[model samples]
Target: MSNRKIKTFAPKGTRDFLPVQMFTRNKIINLIKKIFEKYGYEPLETPSIERLDVLTGKYGEEGDQLIFKILKRGTGLDKVGVELKEFTVTDYKDIIDLGLKYDLTVPLCRVIAMHKDKITFPFKRYQIQPVWRADKPQKGRYREFYQCDVDVAGSSSMLADFEIIYMVYEILKTLGFKNFLIRINNRKILNAILEHCKIEQNKSFFVLSAIDKLDKIGKKGVINELKKKNINEKVIDNLLEIILLEGTFEQKLNELGHIFKENKIGNEGIEELKEIFYYLSKTDIDSDFYSLDLSLSRGLEYYTGPIYESVVKEPKIGSLTGGGRYDKLIGMFLGEDVPATGTSLGIERIIDVMTELNMIPETKTITKVLITTFDENLKQESINTTWKIRNSGINAELFFEPLRLNKQLSYANKKGIPFVCIIGPDEKKQNKVKVKNMKTGEEKLIENNKIVEFIKSITD
Candidate 1:
């Protein structure tokens, strides 16, 4: 054999979850899925790959660059004397036609566009899936991760927006997050600010991109970035003054009402916020859990109306969830526009935070009981007992070999199995099995037909 070493690690920015980790992840996902279903959203799943054109221009410039593109297959350049490393950036279009989806929303839009005829209007759906990005791996950031998204399409009412926010509130509370904030803003208000500053239409995205980084880069960094783009200094001052404006949700809205009195879109955005807050006040949601923050500009280009992000006050990790209304995204696929609103729960980050906070329960293994083979003669008895317990929905594993009883018990202890069932020749003849409580060292003789009940009594 060659002496070269084979790489055994997973690629960067991805992970291989062990059973212990998967148990917690599944628990969290199931909880989130339950909450989504409770809100009248149905489940939907789309393919992992999509046509390149379908995903290209939807996210902003920085987001577009993070997409993981997939090259075409079976285009035999080798037979034609071309090598794989010889291709240049200009040749990508000819060799690449597909890419991994950047997020769940784009593919959903494509689906609605293609199936609008058969589907009902105002379709509410939830999707829990993995999305790929070609980004530098960092703490709590991965190139491949799961996004749990719930969305409502074909509705223009701000009620849909409120539902999305309320569902976020409910989910975080359900997940045992006590100190978190749901920061809400409207793109129309940001657009009006840009207009008030006389920021050119072409450079609007650049200005927003800089503003989005205010949390990461700080005010001075944002100012420097804007200055680099030749934005007038006085205009930058005026823009920051409004963006950094602080007060209660109502107070800030009232202040902006005077600032943008003549600006139709700005006034419309402010009115939308007032209506959402009015709806929120009628509910039991705590006012401290949600707020209106003008600086909360989501990086995606598709968000056209109210946008919100959920963040934990403690660990200082980034957003746990993000999304907003995209009234025009579906229109890209269909001939006409359909109003859509949604939010995506960043499950990976949430799990990381839970782990840090010691919130995830200890779950070493799923096997509840181990059925040990006493010997070759009694192996059949153990096998039958294992199946009997399994039939009753108890997670039971049969020892593969008729090893010594102590060795089988050792295996159960190592795997953290709570109970062990022993059926030796004597017990088999007596029509009974010995069940040992691995945690307590207590042993009992359970009747053959009572095995399932005995296991459930303690485990459940």
Candidate 2:
């Protein structure tokens, strides 16, 4: 045999899903889609690959760095034998044109832009699809993963933000997430906080990115990161104090108002937060489930108003979900502003948390019953029995080979198929079939016509 062969290992940060994993993944996705649909969100899909320029400037500086760009075809990539050689290339602009989509929101904007005339205002959409990122993969992080995003466009009211928040609350509750908080903060408020701290604009993005990691790295670690960028130690200390402020959600908002009372942008943000909470208070939402975390500064540049993130209470891996209002994103492509609000369910993180907690539901085989032939001549009987069982709305599998009694029963048990139908000479003589309960190891001889009914009785 030729030694030339492909490598067996998957890429470093990607993984292959086995049968059990796929089942769980599908159930989660379907549940999310149903919730999205219930809220009047239509399904939308965009291509996995988009022009690099469209994704580059949209996700802020740190986010831009994590995009997986695609190189142009025929870029003079050298090759020798079975090994590939490094390209004699210099300019990124010349080599790269497309990139794997990093998130669903941007493409949603692009779609709205291209089809503005065809679509209605206040368009609601949900996209469940895989996105690629070139980040260091760790627990609950993947190079390629699915995001469940539901967004509504063309409405800037605080009501829009409130709806998004309510949707997120319901989603978490439905997903069996109990100890979770829907913490929200406004971009304008973050801007105001920076103004109070006297941090410069050029460094604000870097500052927000560093601060966003506060949950992962403690205050000291965040301070070290800020110091690397030459931010003054005093400024770092004050910034930490401002973002990490504590107390009741309302009381904290009052404190923020006092700090930025003279600052117009800050007061505007304060008023916005106040209005949101005032409206939220009128609803039946659990106060404990949704609240404010001033430190929750989502680092995305596009978020112009209310940034939201959902985090678990203990064993925090990262934000379980995140999104916000971006009033100007669609205008970049359509030349007209369309205000929108959204939330993205980080599916991989949810799965990881569920797996660690053993919350994934035990899923047995889809096939409810197994039909095995007693002998070579009984294959016809097996086929007929399998078809009848399936026709009666039961999942049934047939044994193609003539096997021993123990082997046939073992196959049924191994597959987790609860019922097995065996047709043999003695049963054929009596116009009956032997039904075995795989779970209880009990056998009963039933009339041939009642085989399907007998299985259904046990299953249903």
Find the candidate with the highest lDDT and give its number.
1
Q: Model 2, range 1-460, lDDT digits (tens) per residue? A: 9999988998877989887788898888888888888889899999999999889999877789999998787665423354446645576877788999999999999999999888897998999899999999987889999998989999988887888888888887898887888888889999999989999999988888898888788888899999999999999888888888888778888999888888998887777788788878888777887788777788678988888989896666878999999999999988989999998999989888988878888676778888888887878988998899899999889888888978988887776878888899989899898988877888999998988788888888
Q: After superposition, how far is residue 356 of candidate 1 from its true place, in Å?
A: 1.3
Off by over 4 Å in 1: 1-5, 77-91
Question: Candidate 1, residues 31-107: lDDT per residue as tens digits?
Answer: 99998899899999999999998999999778888999876776565266667675555766787789999999999
Cα lDDT computed for each candidate against the true fold? 0.91, 0.86
TM-scores, all models, native as reference: 0.95, 0.91
Candidates in order: C-alpha RMSD to true structure: 2.1, 2.8
Ten-residue region with minimum lDDT total, candidate 1: 74-83
